[model samples]
Target: MMILSWRRRRGGHRTTKAAFSEENLSTNLAIPTHFLCPISLDLMKDPVTLPTGITYDRESIEKWIETGNQTCPVTNQVLKTFDQIPNHVIRRMIQDWCVENRARGVERIPTPRIPVAPRDVLEICSNIMTATQRGDHKKCMELVEKIKRWGRESERNKKCIVENGSGYVLSALFESFSSISIEEHKFLLGETLSLLIRMLPLGSEGQSNLGSASSLRCMAWFLKEKNLSSCQNAVLALKELLGLDEKHVNAFAEIEGVEEALVKIVKEQICPKSTKASLMVISHLISSSTSSENTISRFLELGLVSMVLEILVGSERGMTEKALSVLDTICNWEQGIVKARAHALTMPVLVKKILRVSILATDLSVSAILKLCKSQEGGGDQQVEALQLGGFHKLLVVLQVGCGEKTKEKATELLKLLNQHRGRLDCFDSSMDFKYLKRPSL
Candidate 1:
């Protein structure tokens, strides 16, 4: 046997033996080679033997398998099965060694919890359905808590839960409880939504169950909750559910306070993810042919135009694109155009973003500016503002740098519109580089 010795640092918190210096190991007592995991070279906390007759730490081997490899680490042979068997004898020896080396600063590893099995997840889902059918709120809540815990325990556990059909049961429960006032079952609803959020990319049946009007109302109610987690999950779930079908988009538009809640989420800037989800929801609603006009008016009344302009000023590339996309959709309506033109930041911000962001952003910016310029009330004024703010130069650059075909058309039309004002405005400078032009303060 090879003998190795290392001085353990006092009060050190390192987990792997490899972290220790080779110089420190020159004079320490020998540790059995079998005691260390082949993968990590650390003491095995939960030793298990593979089908290849190789024993390694359970976590290390499981991680190796999870990363898409199918071969035994040491044997370099194809694994017939990924099942791992607990090596109780090795675990006992390792524990005894730790006890014997307590004076050397070695700590004993505690036994690891058994991983959740598929049968365990199936039993929980069956019980949840039973409890839900019997009106046993207490039992249902308890089982839901267990499912939440297991889902959070590991990626494997979450996959097992989803594959075992927990999503159907949870969706049914959510739909059933949505008809009741939120205050009556706040905790139960909140927990169920949290779990459902984890099991996303829900199946068709699950999405159908959650896409009902009442369920959408429940999601809107959760969006108004004081708890940030509930708000985040609610909006995320709503976005997914709405995406299942176009009819759900129209239904969501009719939900009381749905528009308000989404707008408030965007305005408050709760978190970036929630904000993006809310924007997507809004986009769906506004794009729906059945409810486009009503949805646009409602969102405009909710002050969406100003909020999006504020976002465009400081947000990053992805978010800026979304905000502009929403803006462009809103500008499709005359009311949307009027509201956007009325805002102080509308012209300057739109002109500033013309060529600065991505090609998609340039497309949206040009489209929105074209709509604003077409506004009969302020058409000439917007054109003059575009001229003074170097809109003429930016439009020229858009044609040069390349943009979408439609954007190209809009750019050409906008160039003609701005050119009409170029001779009238004394501040128009064709020779000035757009980069050096001073943008108006927001």
Candidate 2:
């Protein structure tokens, strides 16, 4: 036993020396776990800002950013770029810096004071809102003319003095402007808060573009409502405002801050049975799947999927469909781990249900089948070909019968690959019709 033990120790020493040999591998070792985002601990995307308002796109890119006066996302102290993140032994122990998010800990910002209201407040507000609702440009222009008479009045009278009634009327008036002039769309996002006093969430009139409690709620409501007809340009405006495009000005306005805010809300309300707010936030993230692939991927890495699925398991079908659509988008990428995670999370019963249904244009069935084949053990020739065959058949049907041939050539090539490995095909299913799997011309 001693002789055997001595031999084992000597062999272990030899193996260690071999591993360290310069001829075997590069001395510059890759940081296995550190290749990911410090915040997400996943592959980096267009890195974003937290409440600390610090942003970076890449590590070296981050170094060039002036984060000196800026505070750290994990530590509140004023920051410089962290030079030794991967080298920090404590980072892995705490599960990346983002686990202690600085965004959530940001102090409540005071609402910015709004410009004083117009005198004859009720009259001007009613005229503007009425014209906005009717989509009557001449009438709205007429109201704008009348508004010149009231100048700036006391804050109390601005939106509160609607002559006949308040509350529900004002809400309806704002809601009615899902279609309105470009200027009116801009006015509503900020001004709606002043109009929404005595409501559930107070407006941050002085603070934000969608400042007040009421305005944020209204903004949240608009974003969450699935009906296209019930939406507004404010969403587009907000996002556009945040984006670097002057051309997209009108398209992404009110939703810019709202998107960032939604992420914060999702993290904040993480508890047993949070109200509808968290679910609404998840819906927005899923809705944004096609917004930008990198941004969507970043959102996923920030823990949106698992948290959403956990809390909103019995959510409406629309929500589930949106989530699945996002999964399809992520899975479309070659060798995306996010897709792998999504597939595991999608229950077996759900997969079966999807298969049993009469296939629709939007059905993700082919993608799912391809993914299944990729995951099978060995990832060897026969299994890979079978999966590609399933995808090819479905894609062909879609091109021939449903959609056009945008991806048909790619599908055809995949079919050709199946044939290349057809010799190895006998190792698997006899039902795989290799005779029909034609080789594509190079």
Candidate 3:
């Protein structure tokens, strides 16, 4: 055994390294237990020592803490503090071990960059403020790039950047640059928007700062950008801001081509997150606006109904819930209902989603089907289609499995409507078993 020791610290704490030799290394080329992170059981890279005297990889420990876990992973003891001290000695030992085992294909771990502290983030924010005040565009861009790098380094760094007030600073920069020519500041604007999106769930102050009409227009402009990330960020940012109040939602709806832009994003399927964000923004606009009828009409003109049904056919749970929600809101208007009922996939997709997604999704799906079946325009056809699509069985299953009072009411009403055509449709059998349908796990 190769004995290794270190001097004792003033607190009477001693640090020791694992002792290993060639004979032990050749046995299955085993890794020393101490070199492995307790959390991941992988060789430690950037090991950090917790107050519990247990060492873990920095990324693993930070993620554990960020997820609301306060207890040590190995010891199960409540952590007194979240501070993680770098275990330089262990990191060096791991590096040396990797180097000695290079012939055996062991790769060395690179040194980790020091994590940004709150003070470092605050200093960067200060520089951005000063640069903006001086109209030093070059200096501001440089600092923005540095901030972006820090934001991408780690979740902890991103949290530090956000907690240190980067949201307000970035919003101010975004608004200030909105006045410039698009060609002149397009890159900076995109970067600023990207950083802002990273600091989402912006506080009241940040939302207030970004809620201006000019800022809303700027965001709309980004929705038309050719860059996918910028477009996604723009819609996501709008979703967060508009959700804060009815006034913001109403204001955003008034922007020219806003509905068209959102419709295009959904139709093109820019990405799932962006598509969902756009759906949410549309839901807020139609559901919250004082002039909802006009807003719904505008969305219908932009082909919103068809795009939403296309999404519902293949979307996962969260996306399906959002799309169904938007469809339900849109169906409040006569034109919206007519457009939805006209689609071939609308009834089938709505029925397929029932009891398949979460309770919220089931509620939205049932609500949309209810609106389509009750509408005066082609309402009979919709009810007939529901009966043909096995919606009757799903509605029965919905009631048996239990749902919200409102959902239960909607399901009851829908079942009544579909039952009117039960004998006319061959899909419903008199001897069918209701006890065999799959129930959603509670």
Candidate 4:
């Protein structure tokens, strides 16, 4: 036993020396557990502490804050600020550990770069605003480029820029874009529009300012850009600016090519996110009571009903829901009802999504079908179409399964419309399932 123990010690020494050899060192070194961050489970080179007294690596914590979490990961307490104090002691201790283990192939952590301060961000933004107000396009562009670079560096810098009034400055710049007629200024206009998009998800006040006629028109120009990203950002910014206000909605509707641009964006299918944003903008515009008759007429002329039906078929839940909503709004108008009734796929898609999406989607589909069914001209043809497209079975299912009061009313009305024309279509007998069609509540 003694001989075997001595041989084991000798062999361990040989193994350690072999591991230290240049060819195999990388595989032998182990990082200390204390140096790893709790959130990422990796080495924490730049540790910082939150108000909740939890220390995390700077990058991870900043990203977490950027995602709009207000609570600390460890304590679940409200985070007063995303601004975390550097955990200098822990960072130094980690560095020292790396140094002590350097002979064993551990690499030392480099010093972290300094983050942008809020005061500096405020100063730059103030200068940009001043240049913008003075109509000094040259100086404004230079400073904007610098700030854009800083914003790209880290989310911390972006938060500082936004918190320091960069949103208002960008909005003001966008508003002034129309007046700058110089060819050089046109380039700045595109860059300014792109920057404003990056500044979204943070500024309601800036969005309100951007809803002005001139500013909205400027934003619409980007929708025609050859670069798909520019067009997407332009649409996204428009959607974000379109808060639930009649004034904003009306302003959007008044833009000349807004409807056409949205249709083009949807048809191109740039991406699902961009397509959804465009749909939302169109939905809001069509739904507004303040929108002019010309706007609704324009949508119908642009084949909006068929476009919405195309989107509803085999689309995502969100797309289906919003498309149904737009359909329902358009159907409210006489022209809209006519266009929808004329579309071949409208009733079929509407019936297909009745119980499949959500309660809201189901409700919108039923209401739209009812409008089509109630139309004076070609109402009988639409009824026959609905029954032929299996709407008869779908409506019976909705009635039997039960839905909201409004949905049930629309379903019952559609059934009555279909029954009145059942003899013409020659499908179901009138007495087949009369019990399922209960009278809707008043």
Candidate 5:
């Protein structure tokens, strides 16, 4: 990294280096651009090569890794490890240049500290658990902060934390903090649960440690926090746990306040991340095989149908997909069908969503409509309302155009139901001509 100094002038002329003595280059020396690290854009004091074969100054690269970047700054290649190998030749060259320019005011850069070792991380985790056992909440938080920082520092550090018992320690911390019933400890409990969520990639063993009912309660408590980060992380952690196994999903059904918390979060629309996470939590609950009945019943009791319709009417494609998915699940149950039909916007939103958002939305929308219209013979007045609302035309267009097989089947079944009641009205089989179809106000 010994850089030659070349000064660019107004006319693009570089001042000659001939003015410099061999003993001291000018401190005002314009460093060569290549001599700078790609990330920090400063001289490479301790250069290191990533797996991508690109080099960066050690501190900048380590900070990037600590911030959870998985790719090289220059090449954008996935880094196998943040364990960067030192470019000794570059370091020596930088030192020599610094020595040469010492008389001119350039100071030599100090070497970087060594990377944290796995044994040290293990020791921290061991200390964390011991502190927790001794009821040392203050020391526990300090230890947890250390582990959190280490985990965020690099993927290697995260793996080390999980392997060195950080996950279990965090889980135990969650359990202990949640059971105390102290108001002040709530913040610490939320933080602990948040850490558990950050370590979710540790897979089944890590997920299992978080399966306690007390942990779920801790998340539910977080849902009530004024802090948006805590709420969002709690939602995310719940979603992650539900995704891990059926037992976990079923466990959610037993949690008394979670369904209501999620509904409130969705209705509040705090942020896109929290709303999406809350919707996903509801989706998983409804879609789970063993828990669908109980989950749907509880959601309906919480007036989830009305809240979902509100979300669906104005949501974008992503929200629409999840809303429709939950709606589709709800529509299959008798209680759900009763609630949906009772909702004023359910029919119109269902009709409007078909072919309006995405194929997945279309599929879920079609399934919901089929269930609603087919629940009774000729779908009763629902069929007439659908035809009057332009749902008849939408179903026909669904059949005429491209869609998935299940969507097509549901559409055909719905069309037959609409046709069964078509004779009652002056409606026509105007599947081909768009001009003949009168759109409903809804």
Candidate 6:
């Protein structure tokens, strides 16, 4: 497709004739934005060069090319530009780039860089501090010669943080954010957050040293900026970037509305996949944020309990481990969200799930239920029935069919719990395959 040259720039070239040129437009135009740029027509490199020896920014080319600038690649024509390019083209571009950048292997690896002297680094870090303090971010950035330089600078700045006063300067700048007009503050905060997030990653794989602790302080500070819409997004983006889903519990503790946002991500993104991978993330979050009782309660209200149960009994061991871990949080933790009160709990979904897993598989699950049953004077009669009718027999079989003596301890405890009704002793033992369970006294 042909494109008009730099409009007001010296190298600008405007097409004289018109022709339909978008031969690569995707087959799915109604998909909101896919058709904006034909996926089939990919530009491996940016500052796309044209057959006419002219080049334009990818975004600019996409805009003007859709306005009927379709023409021979060699000839300048006004075939298409905006009429063909829907208003959502920009949206498509961002989604496409962000997704592509996020997908592994799509990003090019940077070449290795030689190290700079520590004293030289200190001199440059001092300037970065001065520039950043004066709000000269551009000049500060120019100090780093390569991507690796960010780490070096971060380290140097951290070591002599007292001498350069970066911490004080940054804190002062952050204060200015709240007092400024919302729009301007947002823009400034957005840049500040972006820099902090990138600088905050755990140092490169197998690095000799860790990234500066000060960088973490900066990143954590950005996370605390939940008051701004963009900053909130930046914090979430950082969580995603570092795979620190669990960290948000603490990272976002002071940030208002983060719990709701995190719950939304799990409900919307994590649960939908239901893959062992997604469950891994959820499990990590549950473990990291041990005290998110409110969030865990929201999960059940969001109808996530069913999904968690399904994963807990699924064949994927990793997923089951994660799901069980989450269940343990709600059912066993000191401040559990899933209370022992089983008033209206008529459904046996949780029971069925535990029953489905191998006797050994529900080890933690059985423990969680046992913890739930513990009360002030100890579990009551109804709680005992809850355990029995809730299919606590899953562990009974572990005792009866003690082929591997897997739940030997658990089985004994469960039996003791059932010791309440000596007459009902037969009822509990009946569920077990005592014949196969006997692994011999030895």
Candidate 1 lDDT tens digits, 111-223: 77667877898888789888888777789899999887877777777788888899988988888777765678888989999989877878888888788777888888888
For each candidate, give its TM-score against the true structure: 0.86, 0.33, 0.76, 0.77, 0.72, 0.40
By lDDT, is 3 or 6 better? 3
* Candidate that would win on lDDT: 1
Q: How would the candidate models be sorted by lDDT, starting from the highest?
A: 1, 3, 4, 5, 6, 2
> lDDT tens digits, residues 1-442, model 6?
3231111112332322232122312111222232223322332223333454344434446445555456523355533332221233343354465344322212222222222334554566566557656765456445433323445544433343333333333333433343333344444545444434334443332011111223223334443444444434344434443354344434434344434444444444333332433344344445564546665555555555555654454445555665666666555444443443342341243455454655444565555555555644435553466455645556566555633443466545554555454345444554543333333232
Worst 10 residues of 5 by lDDT: 6-15
Residue 15, model 2, lDDT: 44
The C-alpha stretches of model 4 lying farther than 4 A from their native spots are 1-43, 47-110, 182-184, 198-204, 400-403, 423-430, 433-436
Prediction 1 global C-alpha lDDT: 0.84
Show the colliding residue pairs in model 3. none
- The local distance difference test score of each candidate is 0.84, 0.40, 0.82, 0.77, 0.76, 0.43
The digit string of per-residue lDDT tens for model 4 on 352-417 reads 888999888888988988888778887777888888887877887887775887788878878877
Residue 299, candidate 6: C-alpha displacement in angstroms: 6.2
Give lDDT tens digits, candidate 3, residues 110-183: 89988998879889889998888877789889999999888788877787888899999988877777766545
Better of 4 and 6 by lDDT: 4
What tens-digit string does per-residue lDDT give for candidate 5 at 1-442? 3445532233433334454453453336656565579998878877888777887887788789889889888888887776678887777777777667655545566665445677797788688778878888899888877777776766766666666667767877777777666366876776787777767754555576567776677777788767888888889888777877778778867777788789889889998878888888888887778765767888898888988898898888888888888889887778889889988898899988988999899889889888888786435767778888888878878877779776787777777667766666766653533433333322
Error of 1 at 388 (Å): 1.6
Q: In candidate 2, what are the lDDT values of residues 1-442, reduced to their tens digit?
A: 0111111123322344332343323222223343245544433333434434433323433443344435554546554544322222333322343233212221111222232333345555566667666666556445544333222443333333443343343444444453333234644433443344324232232223333333444555554444332232224323322232232222232344444444544445433222243343333444442445555555566665554445334544544444444444444444333444444444332333242333431354344334434544433433344533343344445445443243344345545544455445445464566555344444
Candidate 6, poorest ten consecutive residues by summed lDDT: 205-214
User: In model 3, which range of ten residues has the least summed lDDT?
Assistant: 1-10
TM-score of candidate 6 relative to the true fold: 0.40
